[model samples]
Target chain A: MEAASVLERRNFNGLLDALTARGYRPIGPVLEAGRIVYGPIQRDSDLPIGKTDIHDGGMYRIADRPDDALFGYNLPSDSWKQYLFPPHSRLWTATKSNGSFTVAAEEIDPPRYALLGVRACELAAIRVQDTVFTGAFPDRQYNAVRDDVLIVGVNCGQAGGTCFCTSMGTGPQLTDGYDLVLTELLDGDHRFLVRSGTATGADILRELPLTPATPADCAEAEALIEHVSGHMGRMLDTDGIKDLLYDNAEHERWDDVATRCLACANCTMVCPTCFCVTTEDRPTLDGATAERWRTWDSCFSLGFSHIHGGPIRTSVKARYRQWMTHKLATWIDQFGTSGCVGCGRCITWCPVGIDITHEVAAIRTEEAVHAHR
Target chain B: MRKPKLAVWKFASCDGCQLSLLDAEDELLAVAGAVEIANFPEASREVLPGPYQLSLVEGSITTPHDAERIQQVRSESEFLVTIGACATAGGIQALRNWADVAEFTRSVYATPEFIDTLDTSTAIADHVTVDFELRGCPINKGQLLEVVNAFLYGRRPDIPGYSVCIECKRRGTTCVMVADGTPCLGPVTQAGCGALCPAYHRGCYGCFGPAESANLPALISELRRLEVDDATLVRALRTYNAYAPEFRAASDELEVTG
Candidate 1:
């Protein structure tokens, strides 16, 4: 909500202090297990400063960059989903009292999280989950956690090998859905061109020591985003992909991919928008008390489609078809946008290096060839 | 209502799966209260005759004696659930099925005549029909609890048969195969271990066995395209769930094709 300002890298620590001052716990990317992952951070030293990453199909490594920029890396493997919609959540607990039963739901209030160095694609992913959680039913648990998150988005200066946000029309630059967007300017004096998108962000920015941005500073930030947008390593021609995938129900490529798929739900897991869940009930030894739980689930699982009869999607080919179709096709029909944000997390995370972009292109190419024939 | 009788039996295993039942710790107290833990040698010396409401069978039938024992256990129990890689598949020991047992017996034992084995370490499902099979190397604690809870509630257990990829997704773990070119079996392996290996930045070892309807030929071909050698491919299949039919056939095919 404040005019774009320039904050030197030295004074960046003040920003973290300001967020923490407001009772917000700051979480950002930190070097962990040879890769950058989201974790609680108090100091700038906790960030993967002066580090970048190399990511290809079935390959990832962290490398030293020329300058020390706090957010100088591609997206981390784990998304913000875990923080918002945790892997495991206790829903309610019940106990037998006399002849009646008493049930109590788990408290929904979660800590206010100030998420630092979020990328455009990841922001898009958060929005996707937002729509899902705040749907007709409006999941109270997800809403309670999501409402308290403060998004500090970082515009990507460079693309990773698996990145394709350009094709997905999602990123490389922050458009909206962020409290503040940051563009690191390593060209001259190391500084960030900060722009606030919300009133809370403006209040936070006013607290940090900041200088009004010069015309050159704004131009530099734009140039960096333009450079990133142009150099996306992977691309998906999603012009008619929804129809393309839905029509090719019996495509030979389905059988080909099914063989390599492994049905490991890794793609959906890394995806920013996949929101399937299953419930389990745990009882006390006396069977007098029980606690119902909710955890993340994947469509690739046979039990995910299980009914009284059997699983609806019985074959690997059928299961693969269901996931792809839902992500690219039916998701649009249901949610009005593509399930994928083009972050390329699925492509980079797949054990077999099965690229969704590659799979989609193969189908589109065959469709074109068939049309010509 | 009378408390349901719960029984646990073993054959050939590290007792890891049975240990998981005890490892329930906090939940074990509740489970013990809900059901009469009739016969669990790993946990208690107290033994009870069967006609059990639910029986949790661990390990595989390696000896001629165990082959007969599983049948008696099945007859006594109304619902038989096989837990872990050993009982669901053949487990790691099932690798013996590919080699000559006679040579292994002669080499390991001082007196080969004292040993009693059926040459193949087979699953409980091979001899008797199982109501359900919980697949994993040591088995996930949450899932094992679900199986017990489902049986007590008279409903089908909601264990997933999808690959470990789903677990990786839920945990938000990056894909080890795509990120590091690590040869992983997560794609085809079942989804009970919560994608454990991948979370630690390693490829899945197929501990939960091949997921339902796993496309073994296709996954193997992808590994081959990555220039994974024939022996490595064979070794991959012959690990935790080596004797699982899907992986066993794939490994045998690669051996023959070579």
Candidate 2:
């Protein structure tokens, strides 16, 4: 793959301008409401340049970085799922009148999106969603948006307090699933080491002002990625974790965590990979027409597992157990991978700061002690 | 044939349970076809006069007006089915029952004199004769269909009142409590969700409320032996269906020790 470099911090803006010129809407991370939110970005100024985020369970705050690094930010509160599988999207519409029912197919106009500054973990999360929404049944709506999306993955030069992508084997560096991968190098010169994983990214690189990467620059990028990985704030022992969680369902650690869990579902809501959703119908002013919409759902909601006459997981303890188990254990069965991306968003965003990594560790340690005894 | 008149009524809830009925996309059209939908205000603006064949009631009776309205709904409906935890068993809002109503009113409302709530949020069965009760925080659509289909076919609904453990066994899901030593409510929870939590590798949270013949004392003892604290046990029973007699009894039992 061809590689190049761009020194113009405004080169990102130029790329957006070029994309806009070529009739593609540029969507990327923009500073919104004290947090980095994914929205339409027209220029480099819209990017969270030199701005980093402090992410913990349920809490997200944006902080200013000392340097003018455009792609220096960590994962934002919003994931690419918002663009692919939106919170509220019309699936279809139905009308009933005159003793007959008429159904109209919803006009799904998937906007041509250029996702700028997607972190590697988020890219991995997108791939996980792809397997879900596109793999088996191939959700037409999700596929429509995803098929046209141009992914611009930014390698993490800085890790967030809540980031554990290294543990999940998904992030801190961009590997694939992106049109372009930009590594912001900080060696006296302000430049981005651009690498193309796809032909589209190569085409974009070809269009941008660039210089051939020296062997030293490539080494610098690799060293930077390694440094970021080493500095991961948290880690999870995923080896045999599925079996461990599957086997220790009676572990007292869960009960301890349950005491603190408010069951507010803030963790699942902020989770980049949590994909459970439910649909509802809203009637217009006229009683004849109704619109069906899909919304994000959480397992923590007692209503999520309600059956004929009652909820299956009526207790907060049970709901919390279901969520964690699905994320860690059963996710392996369903998706052939852990549902959790080790992003640590669940821990940071949890109202009571219930750390999944800590909980898992406690369970494992307790089990080990029991076995030794 | 004229569609059966369908009425959706709310008592006291977060509106999430009623939202579940509207959430049915794949079956909503078919449901509409099978019913007149005479008074579903959430999904329709037109409120036709009801002598409804099927009334899907959400929430619990938490006020004097609601207590009266439930009777009217029962009188006007052939089959009155309560949906969700609130209707079947007083919902999480039933947490208000633990504290003094006067204190609660004073805390929540600026003018307690204007408040018209009852001392406690009680299930629909407490006020009127309910034909059926769908369990859940938000009723499961699959079981909701089973209830509707049974009514349409003029047969008894085949909703299982057995423990969630049965469903787990049927689904070949390993017991998280047994295999993993995970504290679960599967042994006491009514089965209807087909053991989703267990299938997902988690313990059952007893969302289906209590199963018939639930051995609460034994389960509580076993949980304690497994190192579950009294506070944890109490919190578990005080969720969605906390006000239900069985769960309420179990929670009260736990509270006695503390």
Question: Model-by-model lDDT, in order?
Answer: 0.86, 0.78
Q: Write the per-residue lDDT of candidate 1 for residues B102-198, one digit (tens) a residue.
A: 9999999999999988889888899999999999888999898888887787766768677777777666666666656677888788888877888
Question: Tens-digit lDDT track for model 2 on B97-206?
Answer: 99789998898898999998888888999989999989986677777876877787676675656566545543434345543457888767877777789787687788
- For model 1, residues A36-100, the per-residue Cα lDDT tens digits are 88999999999998999987765677889988988889988788888988989999999999998
Q: What fraction of correct interface contacts does each candidate retain?
A: 0.85, 0.00
* Lowest summed lDDT window (length 10), candidate 1 chain A: A280-289
lDDT of 2 by residue, A169-270 (tens): 998887778888888887767778888888777777778877777888888988998899898877888889888988988888777776666554656766
Q: What is the Cα-based TM-score of model 1? A: 0.93
Off by over 4 Å in 2: A57-59, A95-103, A281-291, B1-258
CAPRI-wise, candidate 2 is incorrect
List, for all models, the DockQ compared with the true complex: 0.62, 0.04
* Interface Cα RMSD of candidate 2: 15.4
